[model samples]
Target: MKNLVFALFLLPTATVGSAGLAFGEDSRQLATLPPPAQEALREEMRDNLVALNEVLSLMVAGKVKEAGEVAEAKLGVSAMGKHRSKPMDARPGPHMPPAMHGIGMDGHKAASEFAAVAKTGDRDKALALLPNLTSACVACHFSYRIR
Candidate 1:
């Protein structure tokens, strides 16, 4: 009976741990770039997505300090050069709207928050924060169409 009770108690922790690892895997997969870029801007967007996934996976794995470092590095990479204003001129058409920059920025913010929560070593807090981090992806996708 004691063994059965202990097994039951361990189930939820095991499930949550597995889920966290699964999320990390999924985030890493999302970071991959498509083969061959015809235009510079398209390549930039693909690279940014890859960078975002790197930071997100680190957050899910409870590596906040490393995630922050990755985030800063990604920001620097993404911020390189001026964004072209015209859609036809932009590599990946249609161009992202000026207002939609918030979507990408918000995703980074959510990733940062998730990493901070995970660093506390509280599984409950990390789990609770996970959905917010994912929602940023959905929000960005809704506002920006990727080719």
Candidate 2:
């Protein structure tokens, strides 16, 4: 059952790997922000993606707690970005529209949830939550683009 769960998670990530794209975006448009803001957001997201990779690698290696540590520290609410215009939060103060901020916040929430589940060191439970986490990524990408 654990193998089945892990394999199910691996299938889509492997497909994403072979497709040479992140989160299955064949083509996506840039969000119309200033160049600097775009770059800042892009860098932050790139870092987050790298962190996600590390988390997955750790998960595959049976380092579930370590992965959870990384998730809480790097992918949680406060770690998304410290943008100049606005912080990415569920609140209405960010430069991003409420919908965009909501999406970003949801991503953060998913990461936090993953961290919580991973902490238990139950491989099956952690693996089961994998899609919930990745789906947040896919949803964010589809809803907004970085320049």
Return the TM-score for each candidate structure. 0.42, 0.69
Backbone collisions counted per model: 0, 0
The number of the candidate with the highest lDDT is 2
lDDT of 1 by residue, 64-131 (tens): 66665665455432343334453444433234454445454555566566656555655666666655
Candidate 2, 1-147: lDDT as tens digits: 233334445657666776766555546444466555666667777888898899999999999989888988888765654553463432222556666666677778777888899988888888887766666566556546645
Give candidate 2's whole-model lDDT. 0.69
Residue 63, candidate 2: C-alpha displacement in angstroms: 0.5
Q: What is the C-alpha local distance difference test score of each model? A: 0.52, 0.69
